[model samples]
Target: MFSSLKIRNYRLFATGAVVSNIGTWMSRVTQDWLVLSLTHSSAAVGITTALQFLPMLLFGLYGGVIVDRYPKRRLLLVTQGSMGFFGVVLAALTLSGHVQVWHVYLIAFFVGVVTVVDNPTRQSFVSEMVGPKQVRNAVSLNSANFQTARLVGPAVAGVLITSIGSGYAFLFNGLSFIAPLVGLTLMRPGELQKGHTVKRGKGQLREGLRYVKGRPELIAPIVLVGFVGTFGFNFPIWLTAFANTVFHGGAGMYSLFNILIAAGSLIGALLAARRRSTRLRLLIFAAASFGLLEVLVSFSPFVWLFCLVLVPVGMMGMTNNISANTTVQMAAEPAMRGRVMSLYMMVFVGGTPIGGPLLGWVTDTFGARVGFASGGAVTLIAALAIGFVLVRVIGVRPKMGLRNGMPYVELVPRPGSRAEGELASAA
Candidate 1:
């Protein structure tokens, strides 16, 4: 699982990422808490979250086109620095007792603007550092790093937010950027394996859409993630509402919830890192399991049971994410990676602007349990719908029976068909 760290550049990247990711998590927790404190409304929290991702919804494809034409390392420097600047600015405002909800909104939107570029650049940059052989492992390890940070960041942020204030957490986040900047600066340029960069031209955006539209495998995962992300992954809104209204707790309870989820996510990521294969069927199963768990957990009669169930929810969610991500990255040609990944991120996170406020309103009007269960129901339905589409696309039928005294489930191609013939020859 740590095999990717043998490459010096990736080691540096991972080290820096862990530090920055911790700060990122800290900022996320503090940001949500701050908004809730200010507005005393879950809808406001949803709006803040939506503003932060709105740019990706509006301009994600354009950002991908730009990434395809530029050097990722250089682009990262600018984007990272910009994000750090925003962190500090927010910190200064909060520290000065002048921060307001609108200030947070403006900054969140700007940060989202920068992310339109940063998300795709960072995703495609892994191949340049670790090479194709380690891409899946590296991606998994990256998730592990982020999840590990999640374990630490929220706990620390909770204490800081309760004791010192949100400003210091924001400050730590701003300063955390230094680690990544130094890592980027220290990398040996000669060791990099840069991919092909597209020249400035027209119709590239349309070209990318067409590329994905024609491939059922690629479209399937993307569509599945779109549903999961938009509806199921609205954790910020759900967690905040549950902790505040349902449990009648403060930052500590919220932090604990995140820590539990992160611990499970860390386990999932490590498992993914050890694997050598990415399968669409596994992605679908993971997603389905994740949604079902959410439904079950939403109705937990006790807080302890609710928290306990969150672990597997996080695990299956991470598994679904890594599987989909690795599948797309590995399948796309290196030349179109930036555009493809940009589209992927766009669909995955961009839906937040639409889902966030809607879910928040549900939580606000109907209560957290109803809101949470509704989102889970949507996710489960989407997974089954997309799974059916994939079954038809791949010409496979789901089979279930007893194998060696154990129940087994698998997908088998239709008999006497082209896909079946190909499978038989391969076997």
Candidate 2:
């Protein structure tokens, strides 16, 4: 599972990434808490989240085009530095006792702007570092790395926020950029597995869009993630409301919720690393299960029960994410990887601009339970819809059977076609 770390360059990158990821998580928790404290409203928190991702929703494709034309490592250096700088700016503002809600909004939007390039660059760079064979493993490890950080960062940030202040969390995040910079600097250029970069040309954005439009395998997963991400992944708004309004807790409770999810996510990533396939069937099942769990947990009458359900929720969510990521990365050609990943990330995250506020409004207008369940309902519906589309596209029919006195459904492929083999493995 850790095989990807044997490579010297990838090892360096992973080490740096983990450190930065921890700080990123810390900032995330602190940022949410800070916004809630200042505004005392989940809707406000949602707006803050929305502003941060709005840039990606608007210009994410262009960022992909730029990533395709540039060297990923070099672009990473610039983007990472900018992120750190923004963190420090926010830290300074908070530490000075002059920070306002608008200040946070402005900075968050800037960070989102930078993320457009950084997200795709970092994703496509994995292939360059570890090559094609190790891409799936490396991707799993990366998720594991981020989830491990999620386990520690939020808890630490909670304590720090209560004892010191949110400013320190931001400061730590800013300083964390140094690790990635150092790692990037130490890498040997001659050892890199470089791919062909797209030339500077017109219609590159349209070209990327057209590329994704024609492929059902890519479009299916992308559409599934787009709906799931926009609706199902608005945990920030839901968790904050649940902690503050439902459970009557503070930052500690919020942090605990995140830690639980992170634990499950870590387990999911590790399990994914051991698996050899990245089938669409797996993606659909995981997503369906995740949505169901979310819907059930939304009605939890006790905090303990609610928290208990989050573990599996995190696991299935992580599984769904890894499956989609690996499928897209493996399907796209190397030359088009940056643009493809950019489009994927665009839908996966850029939808936050719409989902964040909408979910926040739902949580605010109705209640946390209603809001959470609504999101889950949308996710479950989307999974089933997309699964049906895939079935028709692949010309697979469902066969019902009884096994061990239990009923089950399976996809049977058409006779004398390649889809039969695909369905066999995918099923």
Candidate 3:
């Protein structure tokens, strides 16, 4: 299960990343709370979130091209350092008592610009840290690592907010970046398994689009993740609204809600790490179930019950996350991996600029429950629609039955070579 941890370089990267990830989560929670404190409006918070993700929509494709052309480690150093610097500046502004909502928005926008490169770079970097054989396990472990941070960071930020201040949480997050920098510096260059970086050329960005446009296996998962990620992953907007508006609670309740989801996600990631296969059918089922759960949770009468509902929601959500990530990474050629992952992320995260504010508006206008239900409903509908297209239109055979005393999903192309050869494995 922990095979990726046996690799020396990957072990170092994971350790440092876990620490950094904790801080990242802390900053995210504090940022949202700080905005809400200033304006007392969910729309303001939504705008902040939107501004932060807007760069992805604008330059994400170009960022992918740059990542494919450059050395990922070097790019990470630049991007990560820039992010830490912004974290420190934001901290200073908050602590000095002169910070404004506009200031937070500006800093968040800068951070988003850095993330446009960092997201794809860091993802494709996993394949380098651990060889191809361990990519799936490494990716799952990374998701687990981030989820574990979510479990701790939000709760810690909540305590820090009530006890100290949000400024100090930002300060702590700024300092946390040092660990990952140190880890990157410590990695032995000789130990790295590097993929071939694409040479810069005209039309390269378009080349990537064409590549993804042709593969049903690839496009299928990307489309699924795009819908789910845009709509299904706006927890900050919904949960904050629920905690403050519905439950009449504070950061503690918000932290509790986040913690339950993280717990489920962590378990789900661990389970995904044990698997060697990434399948489209699994993606469909997990996403559909995740959406269905979110729809149900939106109607819960109590905060505690709502919190309990997040467990299965998080589990199914994380399963879809791992499966989709592994599918895109494994299916793409090494040379095009950066651009491919960038496109995957473009749809998955870039759409946040659109979804976040919409959800926040719904939460602000109708209520958190309605906002949550809308997102789930979109996700479920998309999954069913896409599944039908893949089965009936694209001739995908998603067969699930007992084989060798085990039930599995077999994804096969229509006979006579209509699509990619059998690509899925034991479900």
Please give the distance, in angstroms, between residue 415's alpha carbon in candidate 2 and its true position after superposition: 3.6
| Residue-wise C-alpha lDDT for candidate 2, range 150-248, written one tens digit per residue | 999999999999999999999999999999999999998788897669889999998888988857667877888998899998888999999999999
Full candidate order by TM-score, most accurate first: 3, 1, 2
lDDT (Cα atoms) of all candidates against the true structure: 0.90, 0.90, 0.88
- In model 3, the Cα lDDT at residue 337 comes to 86
Cα error, candidate 1, residue 425 (Å): 20
Q: After superposition, how far is residue 242 of candidate 3 from its true place, in Å?
A: 0.4
Pitting candidate 2 against candidate 3, the one with the higher lDDT is 2
Error of 2 at 185 (Å): 0.8
Cα lDDT tens digits for candidate 3, 286-359: 99999999999999997778988999999999999999898788777778888889888888988888999998
Clash list (residue pairs), candidate 2: none
Which residue segments of model 1 deviate by more than 4 Å?
A: 393-427
How does each model score on TM-score?
0.93, 0.93, 0.94
At residue 270, candidate 3 shows an lDDT of: 96
lDDT of 1 at 337: 88
lDDT of 1 by residue, 1-427 (tens): 8999999999888888899899999999999999999999999999999999999999999999988999999999999999999999999999999999999999999999999999999999999998877888999999999999999999999999999999999999999998999899999888888667999999999998988885655787788899898899888899999899898888999999999999989999999999877766789899999889989999898899989999999999999999889888876778898999999999999999999999999999999998998888888888888887656656765444445543333456777655688778989
